[model samples]
Target: MSQAPTTMKASILAPGQIAPNILSSIVVFLVALPLCMGIAIASGVPPAAGLITGVIGGIVVGAFAGSPLLVSGPAAGLAVLVFELVRDHGLVALGPVVLLAGAMQLAAGLFKVGLWFRMVAPAVIHGMLAGIGILIVASQLHVMVDAKPLAGGLQNFGALPGRIWDVVTSKQGLEAGLLGLGVIAVMIGWEKFKPAKLKLVPGALLAIILATAIAQVAQLDVARVDLPANLFGSIEFVGSSGLAMLLDPTLLGIALAFAFIASAETLLSAAAVDSMHTGPRTKYDRELCAQGIGNMLCGAAGALPMTGVIVRSAANVQAGATSRLSTILHGTWLLGFVVLLPWLLRMAPIAALAGILVFTGFKMVNPKQLKELAHFGKGTLAVFLATALMIVATDLLMGVAAGIALSLLLMALRAAYLHVSLKKDEANKTAVLRLTGSATFLNVPRLSEVLDSVPDGTTVTVDMDKLRMIDHACLVLLQDWNRTAHARGCKLVVDWQALEALSEAGSKRGRVQGLTTT
Candidate 1:
């Protein structure tokens, strides 16, 4: 008998494997620290919230997560939601709401809702992420150049003309000019530099460090990060008192929204990690549990809520992280820096963080992916564009909801237009039906109407030979029809190959199978 495949462990304790993970973890730490602070600042939360999430995600979730190379932490995907929550409710009120959201996420995992994330159309997901990228760049640009009254999401576009006029007329424009130059340099380095030419260092990291040094030397009047009053601070459980605000129905609604959105984003990120792993596939349920644990720790410790971050996970994969050990090490490095090098962190420039995020935003919006979505269908492209536009205009969750509704509506319209016809033979004892075009939930009622009109005790033949698609909903309908025909003592003949072909085509057409009665 062939031996069972050995499971690969994601820890340095695995014999003879410690050095590469240690080094890779260090690189991830360098990349994550600045990002943690910047994301918190952009989300209108204290920097410590981001740091707390990063530390817990790496040390707690990373230790138990099924994907060995994936990193978990606070992400830009949640920034818009967090910002809205903080704006509507006080900052202190956010802690308990986040805690409840974490609990809901854990419950979702237990109920296997993570699998539902895969049901979302790929175009919709891509569009939502792209919109978030646009938002990140817009929000951070103000901080990069010391501009006040930072415009967010689509609001920035409206304010752009006025902002540009002000920059042209004021001395404040000088810092903006320097920040813009730094962004250009970072982008160039990322696009042109070969991995071998800078094997030991990440281009974004190098660019940020260089930009910070330049800004410090010039003593430019640029905005800089203001470290928390309590550097190297420990999060206290007293933060949980913020939960009392949830007694308000509006606050509860906001918390539920946060829970749903965070669950979707995290599960999607976990799926991406599964795609990247060369080893065993990730167990999504287990990953969800890990995320829940991490989020709870984050909230309890006064940290921003977190999810599995695709950007950070991709960075970990690129940095030669082979196991979960690297994730653990990354967290360790964060703690070390916070406790031992607070002064050094103070020296890091805000411009450097902006450059890194700008690069990240670019990566999130891939032109090639858009081209691929174009090949699927016009409706898919429309949904993608609509989602992106809505996100830029409103917020991420609303944009996604709009895209999903559009996709489903298009699917329903396509189903309603599908054609199916029935004919009777001279023998009078037999009947034949031809199905054409797609059949889905929207077509089930019409199909049933036709079946009910057929004479009793007649031989029924379902000729799906010309049918382009038949979804699970249709399949179940057909199966039920077969049962009723049999109960009436009628012969039912189904073309298995035609049915298989329809199913295959339906899958390609993006129809999801519900319950299979066959």
Candidate 2:
């Protein structure tokens, strides 16, 4: 007798399986806590909003998630967009934008539009991540020194040198900077040399916890994580906004951008997580729907938008998470800490959070990714660099668009070479013009010249046997040339059988004099 489907699912979620998940959840929760607060503060939203997104992403999305081990939360990749939106439209307007973006993601998933995002070039994706990493590192460096960056990635970068000098030279600044550096040092050292059994303890969490403890014990005069006594007071419902703001082109653009990045990043992270674990593969469309719903809940509750996050997900897998229960439990832990242990959070130094994020940002610009691109080819490296630099100099959407365009351009150029050969059979008064390789609009003039040099009406046999591809423009040129040669009574003949399956028009014009496949 076989077990029922419901029974099988229940068995998978049994109490025995939950113990490891619960343990993993605690590890992920610790890893996610500082990141949630830091990313929110970085995005210029209240830290609690980030916690809210983490809760929704874990419990809400995890309940329905297809990638069992993958965790979701507010991503640093979306931080730049959030900052820009909050800067331009005010915090109150963000909820509406998030709500609309969530709706779009839901529609996209339902329509099976998730596959389209996978079409983006890998270089562009890596470059986007690298750019976000650079931005995060530059911006957080200022925060680590207890200062606010001016604005934008470029401005922050420009001011970095002066800020570093000021921070290192001051007594207060030196203490804060060193504390942040100490946190970074702990994370790095732990990663390089943690005991085999203790490896499950996430380095980021340990670093923050240790740093906080030391700061408290030493009575350091440093800025700490500031949370209101009533954490609920931080929730601001932005369900309604002015009609003009809702309809504003900028607002709509930002929403679309958010939706695209969130969806793409979530799917990518899910895919990555699946590679690390053999338990279950991701159902991308279902994951999208879950993410969409989670984001919607977050927006409704006036929290940050959420997506599948690689860092926490990887940590969950490393910590032995076997199912979505781990993710859900981690969110529970976050909620419990925020509601019941606000004092623990208040003890964390702001610079410590900044340092943790800076370390995360550095990891994002992974040397492995860059090296892989280099090994692929110069063109791949070029696209990667261009996309990364553009993203840093411009905004995220524009940089990706540029990288895609460049990739397409390179593909077209590589596929555009044409090989044309003409053989004259003087004895039979027949000239066989052999065309090979790609024939595009770019090579139309060369093809036209070859056709014109042919003596008028000498039984021209235009053979496309070696031809790989021909564009519509080149086909039209061939047709006009055929007509002219026919008018001259010089018999132009060609076979269309070779190209019939290649073009709709070619099949219809079978046995024509100068047939082309486009």
Worst 10 residues of 1 by lDDT: 1-10
TM-score of 1: 0.79
9 in model 2: Cα distance from truth in Å?
8.2
Q: Clashes in each model (backbone N, CA, C under 3 Å)?
A: 0, 1
**Model 1 stretches with alpha carbons more than 4 Å out:** 1-13, 149-152, 195-197, 229-240, 417-435, 438-464, 467-518
Models 1 onward score TM values of: 0.79, 0.86
Clashes of 2: 1
Model 1 CA lDDT for position 71: 88
The residue pairs that clash in candidate 1, if any, are none
TM-score of 2: 0.86
Instruction: Give the Å shift of residue 511 in candidate 2.
Output: 15
- The C-alpha local distance difference test score for the whole of candidate 1 amounts to 0.74
